[model samples]
Target: MQEDVLIEKIKKGHKQALRLVIEKYKHTVYQVVFGVLRDEKEAEDVAQETFIKMVDALPSYQQKGFKTWLSRIAFRTALDAKRKKQRQREALTEYAPSKEASKSAEDEWLQEEKSRAVTASIAKMPETYKGVVYAYYIEGKSYAAIASEHRLEEKTIEMRLYRARKWMKQHWKEDDF
Candidate 1:
């Protein structure tokens, strides 16, 4: 069957056509995903996710280059998976100590207490600076990203964060955080 006919059939909710499309483009999808994610297991998983996404995305299938569209989906899926994995690794390392960190039990306890103190300090901040502080520090967002999300300028975010940190410092002792 021709690619166009198979796509039309998939868009019209024909399950068999969806299977055929998957079978036909499976190799291409796997290659694209694998190119982005070096791990074979993750590549396979992302390739499956790409096919699932392709089914939902087929309803918007007005483009002429079906292969290109599918490859784009595969590539994006792989990248998203890679980013998620990276974020997970970062989260794991953010709290736990490593040999290079050399933090002792006393230091770990102090760090936990400091974290709690910082949370309390943030809670006491004025509403204007509170949201930006949480987004930047806790959520790990860049100033530009926080600004875009709140529809404010990046400089405004920077100023607010700076003021918030100053407020925290003045309100608490030096060893608070």
Candidate 2:
């Protein structure tokens, strides 16, 4: 069917028209999202979301080039998914410790001791640095969250973390643990 005819049918709530639209443009939408996300699963998910958004926004859509508008939506949806995934990765890295596949009792004890020592070191830092360090490293809060919680700018939170690390390097000793 012609694009304009299909669109008109869709506007009138024709189910077959919606299905035909999906069949006609699904590959193009998937390719557009996949090009940006570079992950098959994520691309598929974002492409589905793109279609949903298109359906919701269709009533307001001008009769411009449909493919161009659809591709733009797909691109933005993929970028948003990519950014969300990145933030999740950063949070996981901040909170989770790297562990070997297997560990003996001695290794477990040593790990616990190291964790305790690190906690102690953080506790001993200056009051100004302590909150940012704990929120970021220990609590796994993002800079934006920490800044909002403390009513400070994100750059100030970053600067505080940098200074905190510098202070730790100056004051802490490996032998002390």
Candidate 3:
């Protein structure tokens, strides 16, 4: 059948025209989707989806080039599927720790408890030393940065950290962790 005749039949809601369109374009659509997705099952699925979309969108389609328009639908559908899969993979990786991390539920709990104890110990320190210890250790700031922020000499920041460590050692027990 001619392309223009097929399109007119399709526009008039002829089932035979729809079936003929599918038969003519299925392989091209599958290949286009497969080129982007690289997975046979997903490519097939996207190709099917493209045809369904074509049926819905046929009324609005300008008769430019039927093959070109159909191929564009297939390409866009495949790209959308690829992007959705990538986003799902990223979401899984963001929260899932690597096997090399070797952290158990018990280990996580113990680590949280130790952190709380350390925080309590730091809170008990004198006001001047507390800021220095927090900046250098918890906040991971350099001595120079801490000094600049606090309007003090770098040497003063170092001395305060030293004093804080000594205070922690004397006041906090090993069991506290």
For each of the candidates, the C-alpha root-mean-square deviation to the true structure, in angstroms, is 15.0, 12.5, 10.5
Quick one: best lDDT, which candidate? 2
Model 2 regions more than 4 Å off:
97-177
The residue pairs that clash in candidate 1, if any, are: none
Q: Is candidate 2 or candidate 3 better by TM-score?
A: 3
lDDT of each: 0.89, 0.92, 0.91
Clashing pairs in 2: none
Query: How would you order the candidates by lDDT, starting with the best?
Result: 2, 3, 1
After superposition, which runs of candidate 1 have C-alpha atoms over 4 Å from their true positions?
Answer: 98-177
Separately for all candidates shown, the number of backbone clashes (residues 3 or more apart, or on different chains) is 0, 0, 0
**lDDT by residue (tens digit), candidate 2, 96-146:** 866764677899899899889988989999999999999999899999999
Count of clashes in candidate 1: 0
TM-scores for all predictions = 0.55, 0.55, 0.55
lDDT winner between candidates 2 and 3: 2
